[model samples]
Target: MIVDHRIYTCHPGKLAAFVKLYEEAAWPLQQKYLKNCLGWFTTTEGELNTVVHLWGYDSLADRDAKRGAMAADPAWGEYLAKSASMGLLQKQENRICKPAPHYEAYTKAKG
Candidate 1:
């Protein structure tokens, strides 16, 4: 399995707006395409105004296909426009990861 993890840093004082936008606009649309949304979170310490989310995919091809579909959706476009207009985010980072050897078994078991 593959994990697509994202960290989004919001513009100062915009964290609530960013989170609200995703909750109200993006989450429902994303759910239509992404099968396994592991979790969504916001930081309470250390990095303020940061949000993190994780998506699980069967493979890189699966990830690409799902994301591509989402990108093509008009609702996704609307969400993008809303975010862009609000300028809620300062920056974002992405990471693709696989479970470690020892953790692979546990991951599979949980799945």
Candidate 2:
């Protein structure tokens, strides 16, 4: 499996607006296309206005195909435009990860 971790740093004091827009608009659309969202969170500690999301995919090809489809959707475009107009985001970063061999076993045991 592959995990995609996305971090968004919102403009100072704009995190709430960003989160609201995302929940009301983008989240639904993303749920339709990317079905394996692991978690969505916001930092309350070290990085104050940062939002983080994790998505799991069966493989890189799966992630690409799913994301490409989402990008082509007209509703997704509209959401992007609306979010951009808000000027809430300051920076964005994405990282793709692979689990260590023992990770699955560790999680199962923890569960």
Model number with the top TM-score: 1
TM-score for each candidate, following the candidate numbering? 0.93, 0.92
RMSD of 2: 2.0
Q: Candidate 2: minimum summed lDDT over ten consecutive residues — where?
A: 101-110
lDDT of 2 by residue, 1-111 (tens): 889999999999999999999999999989999999999999999988999999999899999999999999999999999999999999999999988879977866888
Per-residue lDDT for 43-105 in model 1, tens only?
999999999999999999999999999999999999999999999999999999988988998
Q: For candidate 2, give the lDDT.
A: 0.95
Q: Candidate 1 has which clashing residue pairs, if any?
A: none
The CA lDDT at 103 in model 2 is: 96
Candidate 2's C-alpha runs over 4 A off are: 104-111
The Cα local distance difference test for each model comes to: 0.94, 0.95
Residue 4's lDDT in candidate 1: 99
